[model samples]
Target chain A: MQIYLPIADVSVNWLLLLAMGGGVGFISGLFGVGGGFVMTPLLIFIGIPTAIAVATQAAQIAASSMTGSIGYWRRRAVDMRLGLVLAGGGLIGTVLGVWFFNVMRRLGQLDVIIAIAYVVLFGIIGGLMLFESLRAMWLKRKGIRRPARRSGEHPWYLGLPLKMRFHQSKLYGSVIPLALLALLIAFVGAVLGIGGGFIAVPALIYLFRIPAAVVVGTSLFQILLTMVAATIMHATSNHSVDLVLALLLIVGGVMGAQFGAIAGRNLRGDAFRLLLALLILAVGIRFAGDIVLKPEETFSLVTLDN
Target chain B: MKRSALALLICLASMATATAETLVTSLSTYRVAINSNYTGASLILFGSIERDARTAPRAGPYDLVVTVRGPRRTALVREKEPLGPLWITRGQRRFVDQPVYLAVVSSRAIDDIAAAPMRERLKLGLEAEFASPLPGPNLMGEDFVEAFIRLRRQQGLFQEDPEGVVFLTQNLFRAKIDLPAIAPTGLYEVETILLSDGVPLSRQSTNFEVEKTGFEQATVVLARDHGFIYGLIAAASALVLGWLATVVFRRE
Candidate 1:
């Protein structure tokens, strides 16, 4: 089961890689969000170089989202126009992200930077999700329905030039803010090796007011495109993608997602979010401990490329 | 003074006669083929002390020192300092053109083999290996070099075994060295020195290469040479796997 990764120049248990992929895939499928965020950290923990872990995780995200977007496409739920605009901005973001990644790597700061990004991102996202889900569950137990929102009051945000209408999502919005948000999401996604599904879905729903039905589909579509671009960029720029690692992860991920989807239907949305929030926070806290705690060995060595 | 000079001359003559012997050695495998299942390689270096019939026999039992030096590379060692809530790499030192992996296996403890000054001059062991010229000294002590050795040793890159070389007979000896799974791929130098009574009589050098073969080699070549295309293929395969998932496990 020991498989050597040519690009990373390391041998790891193939079964462990498969199980990790499967575990991450199950979480993503159960929650309908990306598992990429968790994978990079786990890969690094298991002794894969940070660059390889970050670059290779992008491939797994692309694979997972491909199935999702395709399914959504068949159901005619995806907003192709919006997805294209987001992906266009995503392409630019990915290039810039990869360049920055290269610079940080050369500086020998890639590991610390990645660790910081994961900790901060997971903390904020997980904390918010945990609070929101708990509050909703509490309100439901009290038999108090949330008040309805006033729809027409939020036109100030979408007020930008060059307005376009997305027929599938049934929204009129400026391409600027939406594209800019996609650019931001894609930038962090590429650097952190996440699909940015959770980030995009929330921003789409709250900021752009894109329908829940179309948001998941459109986000997955955009993610699929962006991740594909990210993977290609990482390969050309860093040459850190391990083909053996990627293949094993992809195989296990897809299989796990299938089972996870079936299991997800048995749980309520509130409970699922709470569980996911805990998982996210656990990963965040795990990293925070390493950062704050004194290392057993103060000095570490890395081989530099000629 | 006359008597001392006479004894020194006789000692030189005996040393010259002892140096007539030759050390001949060869590795079990000159080229290590790394495949998918490559964890590590265990290699045996078999050799003998070939002495001429005309020469007097060695006064004492012979000694052997085998040194295996892996490919050379630059390494950056960083020490972390706490900055508020986070620990960040604060100070760093660079070592250029040092062997990434090193293993010294001797018939006896390296210290017992020769005196310190002689060992240092010959560069015979791990201590002498790191004593080579380093870059500009840092504000911090020589702790970085020690730390580097410890780190590499933990990763199985650096090693020392006092009794690794076993002599099968009066003239035949063999040393075993195991290259861990994380061994760097490149030419590795193997050196064997034959010594007796604190005097080195003969030395031999050989080399072997660790190479990734077949699928491993192909992948490295593809990624290095055809980056863009390989990326496309990587991306395409993911998409295919994703599509296949939906097909095989269709949501009702």
Candidate 2:
């Protein structure tokens, strides 16, 4: 059935929307990823206006992150101090990101920004994951034993000014760098309409050398706050958040996320990483292809409501 | 001079004797309520010519042309240029006060029915209706306008059907205009004209409104006007849904 979306001022098939939500949710659950990278692009492909798609996706991400973080909280996996610091930076970043988003939208350059951002981000993340997983697989095939090493010692940049203690993650680092990293991720999430968990997870693991167990939980916690901030900002400033669209996606997304978490347990780390890397690369390639290939119709028109 | 005066008097007498017929038209409904299931809508525009025997022969039979135009809106039309193997939007033209939707229907081909200048004066064809002001005297502005029209037509927002209007009798006629599912909600101006011998004998104009009703309207108002409450509701519902998902699926 066709449903009218108010903010987007468009009609779309309800079943298609649900399927999109479920598919993206499945990937999110399986990879422990926020799935914004997949969902935002899919929404645009399905004919939702870019502004509404970007703004509305924030609500869905907030929902999914809330569930994920709660689960981690019950298990005592979250580092409250670290999560709070990240959220503090995320709040500031979200404000700036929303401002930038509005500016680009007014100038009619938001679509290009989204396209370029996705291409660059996915290219980097997917390339790294692919190489890392492939190397690990090759090493396993060689049957070479490697010595166990500690993670926190490397990345000497962690010794920068303003050292702060994160007792739960068992790390001493400068709040400045961590805050800056959170700010960057939150800005990306706000502009891209994601939860920023994917970027944050890697940053925590590699940059700060946080324990894997704490990283996921802490990132989820921060993502929840970031998305909430985004939802409010988009609603109040841009009035682009479509509540009905968000609700519909959430219905299928919640159910799919549950099943994804269950299925994720059976997969090995390297294999899972390989699959996720492939998924990211595929989306990145599709976006890049749009830039390289001739568009079917170059001219697009939107009616100004005001 | 005496002969010319006598001829002019004869002509004036004949002109006074001959009269043109007037068209009376009305839409089936003036208001369209768009609900959740409203994919599209079609409106029947039926009209009649108030004809007299002397007027009919003098004015000839009337031909009908109907046009419906949606609210004026500004549009940005962009063209992509290849930038190092990647296509990007390098140039754009802004069109101001352009109709979002336009549908034209006639008894036959517009060109066949009326001369080009006449049609342009009447604003009966797509080109006539979309003759919006350009940004400046740029050479490429015409291309951009054409592109805008082409895209709108492709989306089915702009339509023209030469055979859409049907005449039931010498005096009565009806036409149907289809508004696509993506039709904008606003004031629509519908104009119907009666043409006799390529001259407009009579013209009538009416207006209708397409509005979001029921759940669709409510949500739009909430989002646009009461945005803070709407945002809170959105965040709260997402939180609840998330919590529910975790509780329901925790076992596995």
DockQ of each: 0.74, 0.66
lDDT of 1 by residue, B216-247 (tens): 99989899889999899999998999999899
Q: What is the C-alpha lDDT profile of model 2 across A1-306, one tens digit per residue?
A: 888777777788988888888888888999998898899999999889999999999999999999899989999999999998999999999999999999998877788788888889989998998998898888888996556766446566777887889988988878888889999988988898888787789888877878998999999999998898899889988999998799889988887787788899999988998998898888888888777789897776666776
For every model in order, what is the iRMS? 1.0, 1.4
Q: Rate the local accuracy (lDDT) of all candidates.
A: 0.89, 0.86
For model 1, the superposed segments whose C-alpha errors exceed 4 Å read: B1-19, B136-140
Best candidate, DockQ-wise? 1
lDDT of 1 by residue, A64-100 (tens): 9999998899998899999999999888889888988
RMSD, candidate 1, Å: 3.5
lDDT of 2 at A170: 88
Which candidate achieves the best lDDT against the true structure?
A: 1
The residue ranges of model 2 lying beyond 4 angstroms of the native Cα positions read A151-154, B1-18, B58-61, B131-140
